[model samples]
Target: MDKLEAKNRIAELVQLLNKYGHEYYVLDQPSVPDAEYDQKMQELQRLEAKFPALVSTASPTQRVGGEPLDKFQKVEHHVPMLSLGNAFNEADLRAFDRRVTQLAAEPVVYICELKIDGLAIALTYENGTFVRGSTRGDGRVGEDITSNLRTIRSIPLTIQEKRSIEVRGEAFMPHHSFLALNKGREEKGEMVFANPRNAAAGSLRQLDPKVAASRNLDIFLFGYGKWEADSLPSHSERLKYLAALGFKINPEWKRCTTIDEVIEYVSYWSTERPNLSYEIDGIVIKVDDLQQQEKLGFTAKNPRWAIAYKFPATEAVTKLRTIELSVGRTGVVTPTAILDPVQIAGSTVQRASLHNEDLIKEMDIRIGDTVVLKKAGDIIPKVVRVIEEKRTGDEVEFSMPKQCPSCNSELAHLEDEVALRCLNPNCPAQLKEGLIHFVSRDAMNIDGLGEKVIEQLFQAKLIKTIADLYRLKKEELLKLDRMGEKSVQNILNAIEASKSNSLEKLLFGLGIRHIGAKAAQTLAAHFHTMDELCEATYEDFIAIDEIGEKMADSIVQFFSEEKVIELLQHLSTMDVNMTYLGPTQSQMTAIFSNQTIVLTGKMESFTRSEAKKLVEANGGSVTSSVSKNTDIVIAGEAAGSKYKKAQELNIPIWDEQKFKEAIES
Candidate 1:
């Protein structure tokens, strides 16, 4: 094609790509299949290559992420991304209504939107073309992530109108996408990001927008950052204008004239949130009129014009009856508390993790001790406490096993540690546990090989170790209980597929004590080859950042064992990707830096680990109590005494939404 024709095609493709991106990313729906999108993108790239002058940096083809950035360039938000105040329940919501009514010159209307559980970012469009994007750093200066931001198919590469607009929205990895990404990362030995929020932030912060582009990150525009074109009088009207500008605005937002309607919207989503592919912590309530918002003005951090009504947490109580100890693949004993059958949130609960022996002693828990059980965020189950009043003299104190329960090997405890480990590499418990970890969703991610299948294999003597899994015969698998030819083939395919997994995943799958997915990635990157890592000393391993002394020692000791060396050889013959999987580092450090957080009660928005991950991503610490040292206590429903403790201590307490905003900030 001629230069003029190429230029025109590039512009047209850019516009079309932006439209498709909006339909897919902004909306929870997609109009075109991925193949169709890629076809058009490739055509645009080819045309641009033929005519370099036509390749404007803003073109859709320019969105492929790049190399590691030294640092993210700071961008001052044209309009500050103001924080929202919070209301815990319908009562507090009505109180907010009462307060707003008292302060208002007239009856006010409210607009409510689902508060998305994701990273907050500011998008800038100059002369109708998307230019830069940044995190909501301190609500003012944020790191520039323009290239990575453009990879979000929903983020309009260029606005239809020639107005300079700053848009405020959420950059989130959808739950489904998060699961898939984590699964893929796990197989490669990369550290799986703790939650979608961390995944999204880590993806966007990549200096190479190409990496971000591949992550399938998405965004939803919630409010106008700063706009000066044709003036919009109300917040609700601006939302409509944004939708008209080909920007994706949340479809669930409602213009509620009464407090009852607001309540209805909040109620609908509290139960409905689970059905969505992404996560929302609460609902955002804003005055419909921008003029009213101006009048309401601000507090120290939050906007008076807006308040977030949080959903009640999904938690229920069950009695802890007994504590059972299970040996991990690394032979570390982890305590699992058996509970009286009870319904919690949406599932049946019979067990909760007691974490370790120290935790059991710290909680002063014993068998026959009635304890409160909690599934924080409706995902992980944990024993909250021992009901000391119900304790009988028959109550038994729990102890860590002195030997491997499966193989009768002697157990040892490292100095200054709580985990009791069985050092025998050939321990049956360790083999079974290691195989489980190896095929875990965060590791090899073989779909059909769950615990039951593994147990059956163990019983049949078909697999003794993780490497044995790679050598399973189809005929043998089909002979097992509930195994069909189709199922056996599928399992075989998955096992074969796992051979391509990166090195870090294999390290984590090895079940070395204290070596989590993150630590695995750190070790893989630092050592590059499995052979090199196995030879490293504790001091050498400890030199890596975030690698604590205990973890370093665990790695060194794991490698020193002859049985482990044999296992590594078997895995090497299988051809796994034994290196870093994605961009090795992030531009934005953990957001919740140095602040301790305690999440109590039922968290409606995110699970306990998911919440902890959010805190960790933002440079904050997550703890288990309300203390003067605690920065924020994220209190949820049926909070019991922790809420009272937080209030009593005057610790900065945040309901779900406030906590979300605190992390985003």
Candidate 2:
């Protein structure tokens, strides 16, 4: 076909294919067979390849996916994706309804929807063409996963309505997809995902869109961030309009005129949820009237007009066969109950966390006793309680191990802490866990060095410490099982790349007793270099607002360790970065310099972390709570107790926009 003919034909094919895909994937009703859709898509692909100039980014053929991305870019949301407060029972729902009614001063109609247990995402369309898609990282800023999202057939590349809009939705893996994915992983000898939610999240976060497409991810658009169209009066009407605009709206949603009706809907779905192909943890009820929703506003973290009624966790009774102990990177020994295989919340439960020795003692848990098994938040398996009535005289009481399971080192319980810890710096279990932490995503982030690879290397005696990872040669790596030329090169490159990471990453990777990622960042920003941090006195650390006495003591103790100092020196010799590279305390001493600032509520432009970072970068110190000494309080939507407290203290308050302008200035 000629250029003009190809353009018209491509447009026609795109519309037809998108419609068919929507019908099949979203509505679960296919008008055309797979072969018919495939033929049309193939024709479109052939024409697009012949006439490359005619191809558009939003073309249906592009849904097959593109080249892998190096990393996801950050995208600032135009509107904050506020999280919903949860209602556990009928009373909570009633209370939520009462609050909405009281605030609106009218009888409020509610829109109840199945809260899809999946990753929340925001999609922005420019003139009906999908422009960008992002993960709701922290409400305001998110990672741009546009390429990955495009692979989802339910998410239309172009909407029927020719208008700029931003819609929010849950991207999920169906039950079949999750099962298939886990089966595939099991076959490959890879760790299986715990649940569909985790599977969906992992698939979406993949660097390659092809990987995401293979996972068979789907989405249901529920709400709009920005709608540049004719105004809708109610949320129920908006849902209808969204469907009309070729968006996938969840069919399970209902409109309730009264609180009792809402309660009925919730109760009906609580049992019916398991029948659906997709997973849903709860029911999300929102005020039907948009005007009422607007008036009701939001709280610090969630919307006041809506609340999620979470279904009570699924439970099963099983015999506790034995107790297993494992040591974490922090050297804390944790007990896990090995149970007789039982199913709970759609997954088999063979083991559950006993948390610590105290939990076992408090619950009077014993091996050979019947125990109630339940998923904490329908994710992690936990032992709820012991069936005391079923307990026999032959049951064995479990005790905490006196020595480290891996290294046989004496374990000591720290003062004021419930967990008994192995104090041995050279503990093999601690070293292995520490190495795993060092290469983790938020730490040094050596991409190809997964848990399996780390274990393999440790077992083979190839790597004994974090610094030894850099010393891995391609020849030696190739000798290991499953380590091909390409894999070795990728791992080597990742290791080399990790050497340039900021000091905070290295600090966090060290697995200090109480130092977390955020704390590491704070310390890195404060000290600027590893040497400076090592030289910093306990008094200097405690002087910082966020650093507590425990953290300060830990930092001092960690730096004082001769072995740790040697390790730092060895890493330094290998050209590993030791300096802070991120935005630090500015020397300019701007308006916010030395000012105690507290950020509360949800900001449209900046997430809480971003706001805190910004405040600190401008020489300001951010505090968690409102205090008498607080100089300023930046309050956003639904600023609750913090705002009220700020008002009481007569402290100056700034809105999100105001804070933005100040930071910009």
Query: What TM-score do all the candidates reach, one by one?
Result: 0.57, 0.77
lDDT of 1 by residue, 620-649 (tens): 766787888887778654454566577668
For residues 1-665, write the lDDT of model 2, one tens digit per residue: 67898899988987788888889977889999899999998998998889988888878788765799999999988888876766778888888878888999988888889999899999999988998999987577889999999999888888887889999999999999988998998998889988888899999999999999899998998999987647679889989988988889998899889999999998888777768988888898998888888898875557789887888899899999999999888889999899898867766689888999888999999989999988875778988888898866999999988889988999998898899999887888888999999999878989999989999999999999988998999999999988899989999999999999999899999988789877898899889999899999999999998899999999999889888999999999999999999876564447787799999886757778778867876778889999999999998764656876887698999878779888878
Can you give the lDDT of residue 586 in candidate 2? 60
At residue 483, candidate 1 shows an lDDT of: 87
- How accurate locally, in lDDT, is each candidate? 0.77, 0.87
Q: How many Å off is the CA of 330 in candidate 1?
A: 17
